[model samples]
Target: MPATFSTLAEFRTLLTHAPKIDAIALGEAQDRNGQLTKPPGALGRLEDLAIWYAGWRGTARPSIDAPQVIIFAGNHGVTAQGVSAFPAEVTEQMVMNFQHGGAAINQLSKAAGASLDVHALSLDVPTQDFTQTSAMDEAGVVDALVAGWNAVAPHTDLLVVGEMGIGNTTSAAAIAHALFGGQAEDWVGRGTGVDDAGLANKARVVREAVALHAGGDGLDTLMRLGGRELAAMAGAIAKARSLRIPVILDGFICTAAAACLAQTQPDALDHTVAGHASAEAAHRALLAQLDKQPLLALNMRLGEGSGGALAINILKSAVACHSGMATFAEAGVSDA
Candidate 1:
């Protein structure tokens, strides 16, 4: 299936037909696990992961090959309010670093045997400081989303989506607060290690933005409070779901994309795996709301798909144990 969507409504409709995990294959994967040349449940989460991947791929023995990372980098006007610990310029600088193969994600991608991609989108224009008004109008949001969906549609492989906008955690928190109805302090955290004054200001800014458009719902809320890269990620995740491709969501900013999609279409969450638990205070609440359990708890807060890159190994191990290991019957081991 081609990943082509010119409108947000079109993308939303695709979710209606998103392929569901194969139940029969899922059961067989678990059964095969029990028959492997090892004690029952000896591999813990790895065993469970094999079953999950099997269901997603509709294969009892799943494979993880040629994983790819798509990183969307944008700029936020709200950084002017001192909501972030770093300047907004860092977004563009890090994007250049990614292009030069020097960022953390570049190294992690090489180590994980995955390709790295980065999109440096329009950073400055039309992104209003949310403390004043909506981030982008409906059309602008849709355009960003279309770009993201188009990027993912052609690739048929395991996917991980990441973000690179400075002050994006601020955008994510604001979006979360609006969708989930939480206090600003509860949803906002120190993005990129803000100081005491910075954290309070970020929370305050988020509260102001949430209050500004408290009545908006669905994509309206997202367009009003979301960042460009976030809108793109939401579209990518939705497209991946529509195609039955497994997605490993990165840390805070990335999960915010998942949360954004979940706000409109809850089923999209089924095609995803939480890569890790982030240090962001709001992430746990968001994950709980989505009913997602992350594979790692490294306390990592790096946003450049760092956690997701590391998680590829664990997913590979699940496939390895499922396909590479011989059955007890094949190994001539006596039944216990």
Candidate 2:
């Protein structure tokens, strides 16, 4: 698929017209689920998950064999405000760790049989401090979005987009606060193990940034308050929707990025499911706002797609039960 969007307005138009899930296939999957050789509704959410996945793949029986996990890393200029416990250089270092397959995400993706790819979005050029200016200009945001759009490989049945950026939680908080109309304190949290004082400072930074750069449309808000990694995640999610690939969203930062799309087009996130809820205090609130119930909640706060990768097995099980189970008629089992 062509991943080029020359401008944010053009992208917005595309989002407005993104394809809907296959209702015919969804109906077929529901009928198939009814014929499976098991008690009705015994599989619970697994049954629902299977049907949802089938709708996106446009198949009555869908299998999640080609799951792709992409990690986008970028340096954050807001780290200059001491918003994060780690330095901005950690973004590049962690990208190297991912490349070397030493990160938690790498291990989880491998265990889940997913193909992992890491993209560092100009690690040397951190985004501008949103407290003073927009994080990225129109051209820059488009470039980042295009990078994410092209990162997704063809024939990927499922997608998980993660992020690595110091001070990004601050960016995510600002985006959430701006888009959702909440107090900065309500949106900010201790990211990367920041202490009480650091958390307070993070909230203050979010307030300042939102005060300066709020009230624009979703894409504009992203260009103002979102980092490259966040924008890239949004781009990838949108791309997944365009390609009819189901998405499993990660944590707070990833959710915040996806929330931007929701703010743009309310139905833009229909193809996605919350893979896991992060330990971030605002994640649950954000998920509630998005009405996405997470598939897992292990009190995980680690980013780099660790939680989403771990949840892949859950999706695979759902798919397997949906596709691999023998129908009552096929098995010569009594339906009644």
Model 1 residue 334 distance off true place after TM-score fit, in angstroms: 1.9
Which 10-residue window of candidate 2 scores lowest in summed lDDT? 210-219
TM for every model, in the order presented, reads 0.94, 0.99
Local error of candidate 1 at residue 212 (angstroms): 1.4
Residue-level lDDT of model 1, residues 173-221, one tens digit each, is 9888888886899889888999989999998999999999887445777
Task: Name the regions of candidate 1 deviating beyond 4 angstroms.
Answer: 1-3, 124-126, 153-155
Global Cα RMSD, each model: 1.7, 0.7
Residue pairs that clash (backbone atoms under 3 angstroms), model 1? 3-153
TM-score of 1: 0.94
